[model samples]
Target: MTLEISRLLELTTWRVFDVADDGRVLAGCDESGSVQLVELAEGGCTELTALAGAVVGRYLPGERAVVVQHDSDGDERGQLSLLRLDDRRSRPAPLSELEPLVRDSEHVHRLLDVLPGRIVYATNRRNGVDFDVVIRSVTTGEEHVVHDGGGMVAEVAISPDSRFAAITVPATKPLSDQVLVADTMPETGADQLRELTDRDLAARHLHPGWQPGGLVVTTDAGRDRTGVARLDPRTGGHHWLVTSDEHDLSGRLSPNGRTLLVLTAVDGAHRAALHEAATGEHVVDIALPSGGWCGYPLPEPVWSPDSRFAALSFSSPSTPGDVLLVDTATGTCTPLTSSAAQLAEETLVEPTVHRVPARDGEQIPCFRYAPAAPDGSAVLLIHGGPESQSVRSFHPLVQAMVSRGHTVLVPNVRGSTGYGKRWYSADDARNRLESVQDLADLHRWLPSVGLDPSRAALWGGSYGGYMVLAGLAFQPELWAAGVDVVGISSLVTFLENTAPYRRAHREREYGSLIADADFLREASPLNRASAIAAPLFVLHGANDPRVPLTEAEQIVEAVRANGVAYEFHVYPDEGHGLAKRANRLDAYPKALAFLSRHLG
Candidate 1:
């Protein structure tokens, strides 16, 4: 039953982005750009007709969600708008009969907050007041910015009491810099006044919130910048509420100050250990099926009203997300949702662990899936985030490979999160080479576990793509083929060409481009394409906001010039992921054919 290229596309989901306040009520803007709300109230029904074309931003109360909608026209985002039920019994009504906002091209709406009674919130992002505080009084329909700062208004936060507002900024751009805070919309604006700074600029920190008495934050305070602390909002004093010998203490107080949770790395993935809020004491550590939990835990675990259980959605790279309810009293984990249905009829081959040793002797942890088929070959699947993990999961992609007689191995190399902050911080400016070598070791080490060494190939997107090139460059014969899906060819060019929004975060994860430019160049795959050993396949989405198309093009150009065997595919309508069904079906089979030709 060989499937045609066109048939694969038909099986893919042509799902659009459905935005809802919570997970329950869903609404979608179809290709025509009309916002149609899903009707689950009357029955499992969906209507074809409703509201205007393309919402830049839409909010429905009880449906309580506010998301930044992507703009179609220019670089500018749109004006913030609120939609709600007239009486909580009927369909959502636009806050004002006035037309949905069409933001002037010059002004882009970056922040939005929705309040009751059409009291929509906005940040005048263009002005230094990026944190626009447009408070619409219920009695009067007037609107305005409350606390107009002179610098960029990064974000706006409303207190639970609904009586207070605050604006936050990075203080200044480079992540090592201090965090700045200012209060917004006060009765007098005096009691709300406070400024906080730090002298130990090297210490890691994050400004979580400001409570009635002071500010509560998570930071690597005493333990190499690896613990959470509560700080005096005015005086800049701080102390850790919970501290561990290992620097994994995280999760902070919620808006209401009722609950707190911390994620600590254990043997596998990370264990989400809960804490009691009133006194900040250890309550229970959540468990996963084979052992460790998955995904990055939240600032606060989902809590039941009766304080009985906390809900968490977890997955490993081998596992997709499965919601779980943990009993606070007994610390027993219960799956709220059943395990993922067998993927495409493949047996659920659980992943096993192995440590890939780097040149530096630091071990890289990996999850390897043994194929049920005796095809006598393995496939190495790498993850992007260099900062994220594969997690335990029932991923369809992995299943597809396993069903096709391939063993898949995902290595959580240096810079992966949930291993503790420092392990993640290890892949900074001076250490990119270490991360690259980790993958090379995995390709060399696969056969010790019964995985055939000669037929292995490297597959990844984004940083994972970067891994493919790095592997080919470092150990050409180690892998039979390579697939670089939107990977960076030159780290230097990636930094130089990245958009303004990514500059700050990238600086935190990577070193300052100005200071460590040489490091980026030294580790770049373009520099070593001459040494590449395998046939390569590359793909890029035209509209990707994260890794731009230039990354793929540069690598392809270099690979071609080097006379390396390769094929390149481009999709015009996709972003970072294959959102459209047509594009994925076209890409995967093309990739499969390319791999099949070379790997054999």
Candidate 2:
């Protein structure tokens, strides 16, 4: 069952991020950036090979021909390449030779902000936690460090005037991340600096992006409704743009400082609302399907450079997500990218949005996928992000099941964000039971909506996979069969037994092992093994860093011990999700066989 070291290494690395510039949708083959260039009119995608891991420079407007990319996956020892779009005409940019100062450096995150003359990025070595913000110049090619040390920096906002840049810093030290504030652009000397926390701020803030006068910060009042605060970095002065004790406010400050957009279920449901930054008056609201992503829904709502149109999308469970263009000027909406249009209309299943009330009366949002009535059997599709929201996106997987005559249900449980901060906060610490109840309530409702509950299947990945095991043991009668992909069987053991390096984030997201011992034990699926009541299929990668390989082994052992109907699959050469084409190809068939036998 153990994989040789070489085979495991092959699966860990990927080869084809580089494609020819023909520009069709390209497959994401590896940690190296993958991109798909599609010809909209014809639906033909030309792939530009030789492109790096990320689509770097925006091509000439309207050229639409090729994409240029950079391979950022290369660390200090890996191949650091800056590849151009489909050709060797342009010179390749040399990725820094610096050894990766951090693992998933993108996790602690190495962000690079490019202004006309200056560039800023984080210098982090692989497998290391400590980080520093470093800056380089485009015109002159000079490099320097901005921050001395790091804790998890994100939302790197470069001020328009380029006179200063704003960054949000939070470290583990006492009073370190307590009051949110802004730091100035670093100069050659560390001695010359400005810190804005002295200005007096309230609440532990997040998502600190720049506005006209200062940076906008989102905060909750002692774990309640979130409010918006704008601080003038220069003067250490502040203003509360909008405050609500009941409905949490979500703000996305547009690129230009003139318009500030706020959202909170404006459509009788959570929807996107625009506001004037200076007056704090509501400007306009965009409608969304009831119970969808709360803020800037219809898509991420990209404000055109001129601030004229808000480009986004609105999606539901049954319906494939559609890209949209909203006119910020006239409030007109247009569907630009319709993934559903690619499919035949008669075969389309409509997604109904509703939240199942849990034991605590908390509404966990769920998308119910209803197929035609001839076949009432359906599958419950749970999303992984105990911290993520299940929004309307084009999921080829969901569509495939629908094509095979199966209904799919996706639930954004207690841990999901965008239902306001409270919904996400409710899932913290010892609230794992609430999340489990959220799924139970959702499943209990399936039979009422034409689905034959006795014939349903439980399928999920990551946290969703964790929910699968929890479902079988906690609520066995809900499904006939179940599928789990890279799920943690026990929180207590996962914290104590997994890779020491990844435990840092695992502790922060789930709960600290030492501090929340009792809760971790209760949250583990392994603790309730005898309760499993359905056939199960568990799949995991042999070299996964986050969940590690042992989680699957331990849980599978328990499944075997109880003599439950189960099958265990570990992709030896693949880590996390399958990266090798053959391994991924092999998984589809194995899943088909397992589901057919169990769901039948």
Candidate 3:
């Protein structure tokens, strides 16, 4: 039985964003067309904010209110607000009634942490470029600029005593960052800040969480894989708590300060374990659903007040996004949310992990999902981030295409994470075209996995979208068709037209406009658009802030001038990617139809 594309598109998914002391869960669900805030407490679900795109939130100290971070119709200009628990309605509320704590259509205000009497956040309201960590009083509404980061502050962690603020900022190298510790309330003339990690070394220091004595951090400094370490705020000394020889590890201390949840990245899947924070003793290995991953931004498990139970957002190839409650003592995993929308589990396909050898002898990690019935054609789905990976998680588009009898291949080419720092940085700057070559390598090696190279189509979003256009332009003879969603066509134009604050950050990975303009132009697919003869389908958001709408128009225009077969559409109420289900329903089915005509 074939699952209709509309049915897969309409299926609801939820993630446990936060867990309260009283056992209340704040989750984001797509049950109402778009992702909205909902409260799960005492055996019932309460509707909170029905906002646009996706919303991020955390419960206030007493669990009486929540600090919500939401953006306008995919614009990505996030605003912060405080909504009282008593004020929430059983029905959806209009945007106008949700009064703002800090609202600006131009500047982004991200919610970091909600403490007892204050809220900590990072905002670019001052210069609209550099983000500053701010501590605002919940009762008095007074603001304190704790760290005036000269550059972008990636993460922030307030000390248990509210004395220090640990933040990470982008380092000089690509895919690397440095941690900085600042005094939350400095005295009249004291030195307020110090760099915890060596500024001389280019490494990734992430997920700074405060414990009793110091900050628990995940870093790959002076090492190949990320590992857990404890950073002393006063002396700036790192004590390695746990180091893995094979895989990357990220540790987060529970609220009770007794246990630490450690997630190890084994290939693309996650292996979770709990450890004693004081002695660093291994407690129990959490047995998550086979092939299930605690999905990205790579959130820490939301622990209960007693630190005995943890709520994790788990998903596998067959499962939709859902929450799982784990018992730390016995490692018992229980389902907390039903996000599959009652779809039969057997109807979905699970991908088998593979390592396709590249021309340079490097093995490229990939996931292959074969259809139940043969269609003789294949679709190669590229992940964006160029720095991100296609992990073992529920992917609606992949499932729908597989249901249509198309063999799907998701490759983590060079520059993809979950492998390590070396692999992720393999395609940085001057080596940009090398990662593109990995696509060609995959094309040649497709036959070993029983896929026909000539009948394959390309599909991707963002950087992956760039891969679609690049694959069509550079390796035009290999693909049958292409589907690009908010991808970059020209690297030069992308750097020039992208959001101001994002330009410098992206330049670190894709090469800069000042020094490497010629290379950026050469590496761009739009320059070789004339070589592209394959049928193409393009979709973009009119208000996308990351890649911008111009990137899509440029490729679409170039292909049109060449008289290449193509289809293009823009959703006015989206950004970066399609967040609303209605747009996905309207766009994806057409993309599938286009592939069917060209590849089938």
TM-score ranking of the models = 3, 1, 2
Q: For residues 1-600, what per-residue lDDT tens digits would candidate 2 score against the true structure?
A: 211222222221111211112322222222222322222213422333333333332222123222222333222111211223343333323334222222243433343444444446654453355456656553365766555544445445666665455655552321123333323443544333466654233234655557656777665634456667777776545578876766667676766776765666422235566788776788777664433532222223345444565544455433344444556666665554444443443344546677666666666677766545436666788777676666654344565566555678777777676565666756666777777777678777776776777778888887888888888878876768888888888888777765554455457667787888887887788888777778888888875666766888888888788888888888765555554445545665566567767666
Best by lDDT: 3
My TM-score estimates for the predictions, one after another, are 0.76, 0.73, 0.96
RMSD of each: 5.9, 7.8, 1.8
> What's the CA error at residue 208 for candidate 3, in Å?
0.6
Q: lDDT of each structure?
A: 0.58, 0.56, 0.84
For 1-600, candidate 1 gives per-residue lDDT tens digits of 232434323321111222232232233322232333332222433432233323333343334333323333222334544333333444343334323433444455553444444343444445522444456543355665565544434445455565555444443323332444444445554654445655335444553654565555566644543566666666767756776775356564544465566666553456677675545688776676654555442112344323455555555543444455566567787664433432364245677777777667778878877765547677788788776666655455665666566778877888775455566767766777777777767766766777678898989988888888888887776878999888888787787776555554566556678888777778888888788868889988776666778988877887788787889888776666564555666788888778768666
Reference-based TM-score, model 3: 0.96
At residue 175, candidate 3 shows an lDDT of 85
Q: Using TM-score as the measure, which candidate wins?
A: 3
lDDT of 2: 0.56
